[model samples]
Target: MSSSALDVQIKSLPNQPGVYQYFDSEEKILYVGKAKNIKKRVSSYFTKQHDYGKTKVLVKKIASIKHIVVNTETDALLLENNLIKKYQPRYNVLLKDDKSYPWICIKKERFPRVFSTRRVFKDGSEYFGPYTSMKTVKTLLELIKGLYQLRTCNYHLSEQKINSRKYKVCLEYHLGNCKGACEGLETEASYHKNIESIRDILKGNFKSSLQQFKTQMKNFAESMQFEDAQRIKEKIEVLENYQAKSTVVNPKISNVDVFSIVSDESYGYINFLQLAYGSIIRSHTLEIKKKLDETEEELLTLGVTEIRQRFNSQSKEVYLPIPLDLGENLKITIPKLGDKKHILDLSKRNAMYYRMDRLKQIKITDPDRHANRIMAQMKADLRLTEEPRHIECFDNSNIQGTNPVAACVVFKNGKPSKRDYRHFNIKTVEGPDDFASMEEVVYRRYKRLLDEEQNLPQLIIIDGGKGQLSSALKSLEVLNLRGKIAIIGIAKRLEELFYPDDPIPLYLDKKSETLKIIQQLRNEAHRFGIEHHRNRRSKGALQTELENIPGIGEQTIVELMKQFKSVKRISKATKTELTEVIGNSRAQKIINYYNKE
Candidate 1:
């Protein structure tokens, strides 16, 4: 919008609490937000410099202002939530769905019927949930039916109708599935009693149901009805088994809503725990894809609204690990001690697990996104000026100060680039002088790269302590390439990372992807270096055995060794086979040397 027109719109906005929406030039909603003063809150977007990149993008997209003034802040919060859920504005948390989860309904009738329904009718029926999944609803309903003989029929078994003999028994009664309240075979009193027990179970209170089952079992035992007693005993066991499965937390933590959130740059995972009479009645983790870099408070606030609305939660008390800005009608407790704290921590763990699973899914389904996130994270964690899209790690290896060698392993986008890996036979470094060996290899690697004008790695890692790093740095300095590329060294013992001038080492989180990638690079370089060293040592051993052969000069030995590959192969070669490569005289002499053994 033009500055004058925007100013006029802002001036007309009320100072009262309300929900404000930002629209783009195409009249598409960009964001939805609640505010005590619509003008001030909406104006802040254009007036202030937003530090978040997403917020800056949102501001640029917003071309018009729209708002609804409400009577109070609570109303504003509700309206903002509704608007976000409806339009799913670009900058708002938008995971909530209008389709409510399946709820197990026990319809209020002369003989109540239990079934799962997505649509709830307010006709005095008792509704158990808005469960997170249909599978949960099915499992719960199956457990309920297994414990109680409630009719699955939809027939309205009014008392007048039952007396009039208008309804007849169906296959359900013959199959022993239902008690047949429709046929008056089941007493209304007994049916109502079972309904009461179901109500207790739905409220997560199992004591009453278990006690009733025990009483029936005891009465049946006394009446010599062993089969009936066994049935009642089984019902007791089923009820207890279901209770044990559903009740994860303390029973005293009742009637509270628990929420926790874990987030990354792209998404937030918010887990909600519903507790009733000390057992967790329902638990769900919602994945919120962030359009902007929204704060945890904003995400949590949005989550609380969406979840409670979706599940029809009337919980007044909530437990959280961090403080939220939700207004005063609801009691939000930031738990710090005791069981509440433990439950809050559990919720946080659930959110973290969900986030982890989400990352895994992204890694499998969209590898490029996974690589990008890893690169960004590594750049931030290692404090590198640029993302290390091309990374190289160097390691030196030797056996008894003989056949010294160094290997450079390259990684592009956090994976090993085997084709780019190069092995260096240590030259100008006598014996096992690791520092000098490191300097020679690094100097040759980059000097050749510069000569060939090949792409250099953004970051270089030395797979040793400060000594190896400093040696590598000397080579960079001689080539006038010091500080041109980021360099660090990893010490094996403590996994300490050393920078050129820094005295203290940097320790990365052990589980971090950055640390894992560095470890992978280090291990690859070591493996490559060791393989080359071992081959060199083996060849040196083979050369020693061949060198002792009389009249076989080094040139003739080289030809035989090159053709045969190993001493055993040369020993296995026939005289004519050797002659074809090294001529008749040397071939006859090689045949004599191996045959003399």
Candidate 2:
């Protein structure tokens, strides 16, 4: 289809909420999106200038549009998520997780066997979970095993087989792990009771099991069965201990799915915490690779739908850091404080930690990808037009108006380039005027780079507040480089970042990698500047001391320094040693001066 035909199709789209699919010339699905107003949203795709390259590519490849109108935004979101998953659109967020999570299955046969499996089949069996890890599955199964003596063997346990004595007890029955269900030693009613308790336990509701155990222990105690009572008490302790460890919030806040998202430029990590009876039963983090620079709400909405569907969750309420429309059937709660907020924060922390661990692993396994992610994150966080591949930071260093100097530290690909680091002595600016020194240093650094046609930095960080930033901007304007190069000022006290013509400073998350890089640059520049200033002060002191001597001159001191590496070595030198470098008269003058000191 031509652009004119595509436009006509978009124009024919309804104004109601719906899911829209974009198809390429080859009839392959390019993207899937949800919109409250189908026609307006599809039209905006052509009218607006997209910032992301993939979005622009997607728009260009869109040869035709197809949409399904829905009654509400929630329905649109659900429909869009399903279509994206079905078609696996190229420009839609990828929601596939290939890991086969473990699930605790209660077999559907007589005297059901409870065990962990990686696969789930529709055999009328009760499948508890697709847990995030095998360890969690093992732990839950162990707890259930300890609490109930359920059968582990797979036997038909038909009434005729048991009556005919066709099956016998196994090692599990002998070890007290099973109650000989195959031999009909355990009644169906008793076995089902234990299975019901296990079901409640898997759902994070241990009240019924605990109450039953307490009642059995009381009966055993009343019958003078102290050993049995002791065993029941131990089981109770174990159950309570596991419950305490799993419970993260108030017990009243139950049976809801909590989701929180932490996103970077390239990916979004949404953590889902399934809570039941105030305990976290399931925790999973879903990672979605962003294709069109989707917003947090969009990512969270899709992630919630996908994860809930994948886990077969029937949760009617969800707690999120931000409000979202997820159909009229699901209630969205944004917690502000107390236990609800704490759980929400916990979900966010899980997502954040998952993201950090992934980045760390990628850094070691794929350094290029790690660097790209950092660069992309920095570009987004700093709101730069391009990734800051090459950055320079300037810092002024002086002590009580002495030896005023500035240093410029270069960072390439988010790492310090030691060879490119430069230091400047404050020649044009006499006193310890930081702003003037910044202006002078900025002018000289870029002016020299321009003269030699060296590549300019993508960003310049001024290690001070607004005053230093304005000063650097003046130099950039003088060199006709203002607005061409991105520049920001970092205040030392608060680590606030100030941009040109923006009074309100931007405060990045203290733990953000971008802020860490900027802080690293600032600290490196400060250290570099201080080292240079200290050297200049020492050199000036040496000159001042030598000038005090009536006969000593700059040339004589220079010749003496040529023999002795430092003033301390010169002071310790013998007169004969000094005479070999300078003349006898100058050596005597140096010796006399040192002797007097």
For every model shown, what is its TM-score relative to the native structure?
Answer: 0.89, 0.88
Model 2 / residue 3 / CA error / Å = 2.3
lDDT, candidate 1, at 389: 96
lDDT of 2 by residue, 1-597 (tens): 988888789888998998888888999888888888889988998999897798888888888888898888877876877787788887888867454888999999878888998888988998988888888988998899899998866778898999899998999888998888788898999999998999999999989999999999999999999999999999999999999999989888788999999998899999999999999999999999988889998899899988988888988899988888787788889899999999999999999999999999999999998889999999989999999999999999888899898899999999999999999988988777888989999999999999999999999999999999999999999999999999999998999999999999999999999999999999999899889989899889888867788798888877877778788898889999988888798889878988999
Looking at model 2, the pairs that clash are none
Q: How many residue pairs clash in each candidate?
A: 2, 0
TM-score of 1: 0.89
Best by lDDT: 2
Model 2: residues with Cα > 4 Å off, grouped in runs: 14-18, 47-53, 68-79, 501-509, 542-566, 573-597
TM-score, candidate number 2? 0.88
Q: What's the lDDT for residue 405 in model 1?
A: 93
